[model samples]
Target chain A: MSKQAPVIAIDAMGGDHGPEVTVPAALDCLRQYPQLQLILVGQDAVLRESLAAHGRSDHPRLRIHHASEVVAMDDLPSRALRNKRDSSMRVALNLVRDGEADACVSAGNTGALMATARFVLKTIPGIDRPAIIVTLPAANGCTHILDMGANVDCSAEHLYQFAVMGYELVRAVENVDSPRVGLLNIGEEEIKGNEQVKQAARLLSSSYLNFIGYVEGDDIFTGQVDIVVTDGFVGNVALKTIEGLARLLGQALREGFQKNLYARLVGLMALPVLRGFKQRFDPRRYNGATLLGLQGIVIKSHGNADRAAFANAIRMALLEIDKAVPERIGERVATIFANGAGIHEDAPHTTRMNRA
Target chain B: MSKQAPVIAIDAMGGDHGPEVTVPAALDCLRQYPQLQLILVGQDAVLRESLAAHGRSDHPRLRIHHASEVVAMDDLPSRALRNKRDSSMRVALNLVRDGEADACVSAGNTGALMATARFVLKTIPGIDRPAIIVTLPAANGCTHILDMGANVDCSAEHLYQFAVMGYELVRAVENVDSPRVGLLNIGEEEIKGNEQVKQAARLLSSSYLNFIGYVEGDDIFTGQVDIVVTDGFVGNVALKTIEGLARLLGQALREGFQKNLYARLVGLMALPVLRGFKQRFDPRRYNGATLLGLQGIVIKSHGNADRAAFANAIRMALLEIDKAVPERIGERVATIFANGAGIHEDAPHTTRMNRA
Candidate 1:
């Protein structure tokens, strides 16, 4: 690990809330880690105004990147990337490519971000595709799920690559040396699920990754596997369903406790413990999803991320930078695959972070 | 509405907690609806023991129909139906066939139950297949989703018929007249989704079912549509996902509200209101899913249903009998393709419920 501070480039114009949430969160990140540096990528005017409103105009750690174009949420991915080169999303990816920052993070249109990242930075050597890796908070600890919403349609080979990439990312950043990977299926039996899942199971079982066999949808949060792999469509649905349920359930609990006077008193006595529990399951803490298999570090935040969520994304980027995750992932992937196996004898020099 | 009460045969030996849950629920149903008559079908000794425990050694409203054979949960539907002739599930459906009972309900192995129902108490004259319809509590109220796990493989025409059946069920029972029918797709656009969804959309748009075009996964809970239709596979995944989310979110909310003293005070104040809210979302209240399009009524309860859930299934069966839902569905389906439509209209009438 290097003493040099890692710089996080944030897409200030991304997310439903835009600079209002992103700016305050970046400031919070700076306050929490005084050693951290930030390059807010968006319209300079907007970023400056937000910083001034938050009473942090002349902070030594924060800077701005003037990206004039903004990608609308509903725009087509490829069209948006090709037509809007100076877009905040593209500019942020470019920052990582040019070594202007250690990592780039966005809470924008997922499709556009993935397309731009892949187009600009390209996939890592020996990596076929980049997967969106989300860290889910379970009872035991955090488990990583890949392809949250990157590739809606995937092949067995693609899923196999995703598992390997996911396993490496979890290992490198979280230090889970042998993260077990489970292929998501309708049932645990080999004979279950659609054609794609069946094919994925076969490939996963044959791959060198620590495959833990098939798992049902309910086993996701049980901490039975360190990495759960699936296609983006199913993965996205599963993630959003959890989010919706959390909101619906939270509201239900509040209503239940206040139904009567006796319950009200009990609720008051249990408030502190309940609050702690809420914080533990708070989606804000686990807001960032790494764009694994990319040549450089790219993290995606929730579209409606608030200040706390945005800060967590920055913190995640810093963690990845500190752990030299990209370099480790590249080495592991290159060695695991036949294409780059011959060159692995010479351990390539790790890409050093340069904070400006 | 007939002056004479409709007798519903019950498969008392079905479900994981069979006689215990089924017996109490039947008694609860009798108490709620004095006009309802129940014929409990199971082992004579076990049924007698259960009835005695419920303080009804010789209740006039309830009768026992003993059967010697049983169907295990994992038995193949076709094989089970062919072999288990004297099974409780089989006898219940047989009672319906012999005009001894108007309908039958079971919480047994879903596949075996569906198979037996299709084999003995067959499909209506115009109904090509039967679908499992479950009510989901949404923001606005409740949405009826069909084919939750009935038919794994279906054509666009099957989906179209499901919409009609679901719409009719909602109107007859839930009293939502002119119910909106939505085809569940990956996206809201008409062009989006797989071949089946697109083809179904075309058929639905032309049909008299008040089709609302394609809806995304999130729209299922918006209560924007009365019925959302899809194939069994996707529906099962969505249903299970919703259930899992409910459990996870419920736990998270309890923890969140009791986090600290001030929050606990708020939580206490909010307890009563929260309980009322939670009751509205209680899974038990929304447990029963009707196997629609069959000549005889067949209601399937949740696998882990308690007494309350089983009771709800009985209540659902009573409603079906009171409304003559099967006949209504049959009539509606008969007129659906009466203009010499190209699709097949060869539904059989088996009236058999092979209990597993």
Candidate 2:
């Protein structure tokens, strides 16, 4: 597609599966995107063993960038930041910051990744913090929900900024010019929810967004809106609830089939149909969590993601690189602040909330 | 079974389906529990006409108590408590206050039920606010979660009370002698949640209750704990999120089966097995939302419940009555407070929260 390929630097030793998953996933991604290159950032000896085990060697399009240290999954973000300066996760992010790679993908600890990325690449101007944006499978299409445990305590204006950033994400990735953005709350009525969310709703209503007012928890999967915004605490709980319920439902379905002879036969007979149904709700197809409001592209894959899911994460970075989503977001933020969206950088008072 | 049956008053004209759904559901409950008596409360003519239409009329076991007005689903809680003196919802609660009924079950607006019940039946001596408790379907059994929207804002001590009440609920209804009580938070760690939750955890760990530290949102339906305690804001959104996801999954499955001729055949072949799966997850089986902390029993059914679901709500009321759950909860509260568990009644500063 191009004479020079776009490069993605991957934290090869970051996830639970580590190189066993990332090596093959990266190889598969390289195969899919002919005009793409990869830099596997990890311990040199370990990466070489993984590559040899997969019966592959470094090529013109693939290379290994050695980082001696590994960031443990439970390592505190501050520890990773201060001590593990040369860790794989940080090195990959640095590649992006230095323009050596178009984007960076990591399956490392989410908290640490957010902290390291924000520290290395810095946040976009006019943005206070970076947020984790996840794509969930809804009825009509994928629905994006943000602030998924990135900032546990968010101000009203912070939530308003999330709405704007979310709006830009959907428009860029999903080709949705008029993405319906809704603030997640306890009820659809404007009068519901706590004070922060209520104020956020007011700010969104006045912005140049296709703001759909307040939506309830059920709206997350109803495909009623393209993007949903909430504070880190509630958003994180809601997401984990969905994950836990999905696993339970799958287990229950299997248990139901084991109850009787007829049930077992039906399970066998409808295996094809059930497979289709399962794939429709497959969580792996949507594996990447983009760190929005960052100056450079960074994606976080689930820790237990397999080869296919990890590859999906790489593809996600490629899409962002192809479209330059971060630049567009920065432009949108500048416009929003310029138009008196809020005096976020220096104003101590709650000006937008007060105006609302 | 005793010759003198436990009487349950039903708001005959409540819920979205009204008497059309309620009359049949009451009859079903009567058939199931021979020792149960029901008082259908509504406008005399509407009750009588609906009862006759369903081939049911006044009987020795079934009777009518006329309430001239109905509480509209969207009626403000304050308005319902102040103006709607003759509402069916209020009349039903009055029966419990007057000891004319063992319990009352209504499918009316939740806010109205909580407000009216608090005004008429009053809260138990130690509880400042009554909470709405709902039984959610879990992997092992029904898991109870509370403050399911009745109290929009709650402090740490209020959460402690929720734990005690939840503990007694499991002991009474499910026969779990030492019910495992857990506070719901974003993480299972003691330091995972906001200030209110962390303080609640401290209070609960020090209390006499068999508290099991903190639980995440997924624990609600994992059957890992008997009861999950959270503030109304998080609890309500989590419960409704589960509801929405359940409905979406069901719709997606049906849509999957309707895709092609081969899928259609599989649907037929697996009809019985799929039917079992559907029943195992039947939302109607988990319809009751009891208003915990009240002096009398008040259960809130989903406003759109059908005959089977509404009947399930009636059975829930009967079970609470059979176990004398309110009486047991009151004893537990007295036991908890008697042991010098901070003077929450009046502390001048942050009274409800300062107890911890």
Chain A alone, TM-score per model: 0.91, 0.93
- lDDT by residue for model 2 over B206-266, one digit each (tens)? 9888888888877877888888898888888888889888998898889878889988887
Model 2 residue A59 lDDT? 66
Reference-based TM-score, model 1: 0.88
Clashing pairs in 2: none
- Candidate 2 positional error at A341, Å: 7.6
lDDT of 2 by residue, A226-261 (tens): 899988888888888898898888998898778889
Q: Output the TM-score of candidate 2.
A: 0.94
lDDT of each: 0.79, 0.83
Total backbone collisions, model 1:
48
Per-residue lDDT tens digits for candidate 1, residues A167-273, read 87788787877888998765312225677777888877887788998865666767788898887766765676566556655765676677668777777677666
